[model samples]
Target: MGAEAILEKIRQNAEEEAAALRRQGEERAAAAAEKIRAEAAADAEALLESARRSAEELSRREDLMTGLEARKNALAARRAVVDEAFSEAHRMLLALPAERWEALISRLVLEASETGEEVLEVPASDREKYENGLLERLNAALERSGRKGKLTLAGAPGKMEGGFRLVGPVYDVDCSFEMLLSLVREENEREIARLLYPETRAAGE
Candidate 1:
């Protein structure tokens, strides 16, 4: 072949090689771009899922907190109602007639006397009742119970609303109205709650 023909052939071969290289590069770039897009889509989906889970968890916690707060408020209200009921009962007991109180006092003294020789501390407001044969009746009751102890009135009047305190040699017995009511309340708290709030039992059921 001639020199010019050979050169022309070489130029044609070079052009074909360059075209092949360009096509290969374009294909590689397209593949890389597609891979990046797929990875980005997967990352975006994962982020969205994480956000949804976080939101659900937060909502659940808020709901639990709200329920707890509601229960606390309800318990406080119930306690207030129970306290008010006990207060009213105390007032009624304190408003009893003088004769009724005298009878109650005699019974309480007899029940509270341990050795029968205890100083009976009466309320300062009702000291006259004890001076009028009340001590005699208490001693008679103690005699019937087969206990040997002389009962006497305390020189210092007791500070109380009602009821008496028997000051014994070793220990003192408090039969005061306030103390008695408190004892009764503590002992029968559950029963009182059931009576006052029927809904509590119903809820338990």
Candidate 2:
């Protein structure tokens, strides 16, 4: 072959080699770019999933808090109702009659007699009636019990709130209007609450 032809062939071969290297580099770069793009897409998907879970959890928590607040409001309403009922009951108890009061006292005296020695302390709003009949009835109760105890009537009458206090030296029995009402209120507080505020019963319970 001629020297120039040989040289030309050599130059062409060199150019082809350079062109192949450039193409390989380009292909590798494209492949790397595709891989990076796929990785970025996967990362984005994971982030979106995480965000969705967080949002769901927040929603659940909000629902729970809302329920709790509703229950608290219901409970507060129930408590108000119970309080009002107790107040009314106390009022009625205070309004009971003298005869009723005397009967209650007699019964209490009898109960006291069962335990031990009995002394009755009677308070009547009507001092004249107390002086007239209260002592006599209480003494009769003691006599029926087959035991004797002194009866002391509060000197001042009618001005005091209704009820009697029976003391047996050591143990004391209270049958006053206020005391009886308070005892009943404790037992029936829930019932009263339900009657006054039916809607709040579930929350209160």
Q: What TM-score quantifies how close candidate 2 is to the native fold?
A: 0.48
Model 1 clash pairs? none
| Candidate 2 residue pairs in backbone clash | 125-158
| Candidate 1 residue lDDT tens string, 76-194 | 55455455545655565566577765666666666556677889888887778778877787788889988764899999999877777778776566667676555434434454455
In model 1, which runs have C-alpha deviations exceeding 4 angstroms? 1-77, 191-203
List model 2 lDDT by residue over 127-195, tens digit each: 566578767776766666676645666444423255555554444555455544443334333444344
Candidate closest to the true structure, highest lDDT? 1
- TM-score for every candidate vs. truth? 0.54, 0.48
lDDT of 1: 0.55
